[model samples]
Target: EEEEEEEEEEEEEEEEEEEEEEEEEEEEEEEEEEEEEEEEEEEEEEEEEGEEEEEEEEEEEEEEEEEEEEECLEYINFCYKLVISVCCERSVVVVPHKDTSGVTRHVMRGEKCWCCASQRHFRCHTTCHARSLQP
Candidate 1:
């Protein structure tokens, strides 16, 4: 009977050890899950920051294009007299002095004049008039 009690005690110890091991495994799995969630949150934040940066870059590009268009109108002399033909039928009057006034206000915020124009259009009014003669 004592021998049997010893064997039963040994088996109980083994079962206890197995239960402890299972609990340790469960704790480790919980820790791993927490770590994975943290990593995913970090990644999502990074992606959000990246998207914001891209949006800022796109806004900058759009502002630059708007600046270029405004400068084009500024440098062109007699811009008020310039009549732009839309598809060779209707004509749109380009009053640079009035239409470009708002754009100039924005450019003036950076204290820059309308000096940055396309290199191809070197001459002010003469170049456009010359181009109009071409077929």
Candidate 2:
């Protein structure tokens, strides 16, 4: 009977140790799962930030393109206008543009003979030191 009691006690102790080990393993698994969840969340946040930056860059590019389009349109308008310049004695010609209530639509530098010899800004190439151009 004594031997049986000793064997039973040993068996009980072994079972308790096994239970403790199982509990430790479960706790370790829980910790690993939490760490994985945290890492996933961090990755997701990084992706979102990257996406936002890309969107902002795209918007800026679009704005620049719109500004470029406006400039091109202005150039096209200048090309289609009927411009005439008159100058005398190798002088620069200052031609007339839209006269908005005596406000003088086109403003430029150099003497206002403004015919031939006008600067590139004036966009005129006709010179009349000899005779007037036939438009």
C-alpha RMSD of each candidate structure in angstroms: 11.3, 9.3
Q: 14-96, model 2: which lDDT tens digit per residue? A: 99999999999999999999999999999999999999999999999999998887865664444334333223333343443
Give a tens-digit lDDT track for model 1, residues 1-135: 999999999999999999999999999999999999999999999999999999999999999999987766555533323423321233322323322323422111122224443333223332333232211
Give Cα-based local distance difference scores for all models: 0.54, 0.58
TM-scores for every candidate against the unseen true structure:
0.58, 0.56
Model 1 score (lDDT)? 0.54
Candidate 1 segments exceeding 4 Å error: 77-127, 130-135
Top model number, TM-score: 1
Candidate 2 ranges with C-alpha deviation above 4 Å: 75-135
Superposition error at 29 for model 2 (Å): 0.8
Clash totals for all candidate models: 0, 9
